[model samples]
Target: MLIYPDERLAVFIDGANLYATARALEIEIDYKALRAHFAEQSRLVRTFYYTAILEDQEYSPLRPLIDWLDYNGFTLVTKPVKEFTDEHGRRKIKGNMDIEIAVDMLNIAENVDHIVLFSGDGDFRRLLEAVQRRGVRVTVVSSNSTQPSMIADELRRQADQFIDIVDLAPIIGRKGPRRQHHAHYDEREETTREFEDAED
Candidate 1:
């Protein structure tokens, strides 16, 4: 939340991670409002959203949301999800965007004065450190409001500032009944589950 109006800022959103976090908190994020909130805080440069799509599906549940974000102010970076069977013969989907996010963040670090990362994955702790070393201030947006706490302790500690999504709910959360993209939310949850299972 500590932002200066003159600072150059960029937002990196891990789509699946954010969706899971918000769902855990029972909050629906208004993407427009979320963008506006950050734009108001600083010299917003860009917002990048990363996700993976199931290429083989006849009609992807996430297509609507993906299209919406693409038409919006967000930069979409996505790839096809790989479906494979595990050693135990269990089907799994692998679609982690961690590398893509890291590469983009590092590429933009020198140009931006600040970066706002929306993810709770502990894997990014070192990435935050690297950005900070380059004189870029990093703010992590996630939450500890859930029963198990969505934000990783080490990731929170690595950030120059940590803003809980719970606190941001009032400003960027949906006001009334959810929009038509409700189905996309369900798909995100399922994707998160599959991604985690694959990682395990």
Candidate 2:
């Protein structure tokens, strides 16, 4: 949570990874609150969210959330998931957004003073290094409070600033009446399971 008033900022969110982190922490993120909190911190330039969709599905549980985010200040980056059969003859879907997120951060590195990434994936260690080379300060937001610790050690060490999401829960979490066993929450859990298994 280090902040400088004049620094320009951009956010890159790895949708599935963030969802998993928040679920592990047992909190719901108020996207609006999150955007506003950072906007108040500095010159907020842009926010990017990445995910993969199953194009063949007639109905997707994540459609509502995805649509809401698209219309509400987030630039959505998505690709269709690819399905294939393994050698064992089991169908599997694969999707990964690391390259997309890295490209966007690198593309905008020179223009922004700060880049905030919302993912714990260790693969981004090099991406952070590259952006730091361009003089952009990188802040990684992920939790180390969970039982297994969602934040990767190498990624945490590489970031110029690391803010554990658990500490920001009070500021960014949704407030008022969320049932622990709500049907929507169940849907989200199911969606996470599918995506996590499919992720490459």
Candidate with maximal lDDT: 1
lDDT of 2 by residue, 3-70 (tens): 79899999999988988899888888888889999899999999998988878988776677678778
True-vs-predicted CA distance for residue 31, candidate 1, Å: 0.5
| TM-score, every prediction | 0.97, 0.92
Which candidate should be chosen as best, given TM-score against the real structure? 1
Clashing pairs in 2: none
lDDT (tens digit, per residue) of candidate 1 on 1-200: 89999999999999888988998998998999999999999999999999999989898998988899899899999999999998899888999999999999999998999999999999999999999999999999999889898889999999998999989999989998889975578756766899977865
Evaluate model 2: give its TM-score.
0.92
